[model samples]
Target: MEPVFRPPSEANSYLLPVTTGCSHNDCTYCAMYLAKRFRVRPEKEVLEDLAMAKATLGDVRRVFLLDGDAFVLSARKLLRILAAVRETFPGLQRVGAYINAANVAAKTDDELRDIADAGLTIGYLGLESGDPETVTRIRKGASVDEMVEAVRRAQAAGIRMSVMSLLGMGGREHSLRHARATAAALNRMQPRFAAFLTVTPVEGTVLHEELDEGRFELITPEESLRELREIVLHLELAGSIFRANHASNYLPLKGRFPGDRERLLETIDAALDGRISLKPEYLRGL
Candidate 1:
């Protein structure tokens, strides 16, 4: 089995690998499942794993499906797994999974609604960047329009969308464009949650090769903070929970949208003015 990963917020949830790798794993900056082939585990094996968890852990309130983009599974299969989860845990509160725009787009309204009704209430989506050029350059496999539509479709089906964007994804050339367009996209989607992670090139990825060849230049810490501030400044979310506290970030930030927008901007301004300390470079990670 391949290594599995989940959102930090799901640290206490029971992890269940419904898929082995991302269905669309061609993103230029990602190295998370480069060595693993994408495949949905058999229903029998999945059920058996749930039974084992039930016998040992007794009951779990939350279950997070892994490894990556588990929402790529057919709605029927996911509904079946969710049913088994409810039966095994009985007290399961919610189920979450990593998803991509294509994954959400693949399912119909009825299918998504059925899956959500069966306990799968949340989805983590990687928007990466909303800049058209950046989106194409990264090989994200979905366009900005497709991304917005996917999130809206899922939300309409009662799934809370937690969208993630990557800071410095456009390198030095298009930093500001990336930030402003991303903010515009987020404003349109108005996701329940919005997160920002800085781009850190991994040795095995195409992005690293680009950096090596001098084709890409990562922005300086101050530039990244400026990009972040630009996005926050332009965002028009209603009440989305905003976060930039991932380990990959230089500065940690968290606040609700609209309500805390001013505070967030002030905090970023302080960091830029050297009044606040940023996370050390040596300590950053993906």
Candidate 2:
């Protein structure tokens, strides 16, 4: 089988796996966790991966761990993985992985620091929304407050953070509140890097079914650009790296935030009203 996680951008230069499947896989919009039971691969297996990966690529400077949520590893187990990777590779500069809010809550501050010190310096959290109602609707598990506390705790523990906020996650019924609340969440946590992903439904998922049945109306690629506009305008992040460079983003913009924010938002607005769609405009079609 192919590796379950791929680099989301050009920044990552190595492959690693901290865990497999997603811990909070019940989100209505996701199909990633559909085919498998959620589980963290054993530490010895992961250590062997480190050895194999090093043999494949020497002088690997950065590693991005695979799959939906790597933080599911117990603090001690994660620490062991990071240490082994460093001991084996010796030239790694950074390590990163996706983390869920519940898993963030699972570890104590000291444990987070221990993992960071062992070499995992950055965390990528998918804060799909800050609206409690929206989170419940999708079963994402972490509340707005829980997300805030989680980022705060992880930072206090020395793990620098990045987050993904899904634009248009609220759909037609809740877009404004979604933007405002998501903005509020960012204002509160101010992660080191934050990104806005325009939501695109994938097949074999409840959200795809809803779109198919006309039960939920997705904002058009045009409307998604509009929603992203609102999300960015109200966003008040402090010196964070921001990107909308995912293939899913209509306009693949990337730059330092609280800096190019106005230009980025304006560009999104223009892309929304653009005569032609900014992207391929696949609506999942169920």
Per-model C-alpha lDDT, please? Answer: 0.93, 0.78
Candidate 1 residue spans exceeding 4 A from truth: none
lDDT tens digits, residues 187-223, model 1? 9899999999999999999999999999999999999
lDDT of 2 at 127: 83
What is the clash tally of candidate 1?
0
Clashes of each: 0, 0
Tell me which residue pairs clash in candidate 2.
none
Shift in Å, residue 222, candidate 2: 2.3
Candidate 2's clash total is 0
lDDT of candidate 2 over 195-275, digit per residue (tens): 777777888888888889987777666667767777788878878888777767766778777888888866776676674
Candidate 1 lDDT (Cα, 0 to 1): 0.93
186, model 2: CA deviation in Å? Answer: 1.0
Candidate 1, pairs of clashing residues: none
TM-score: which candidate is best? 1
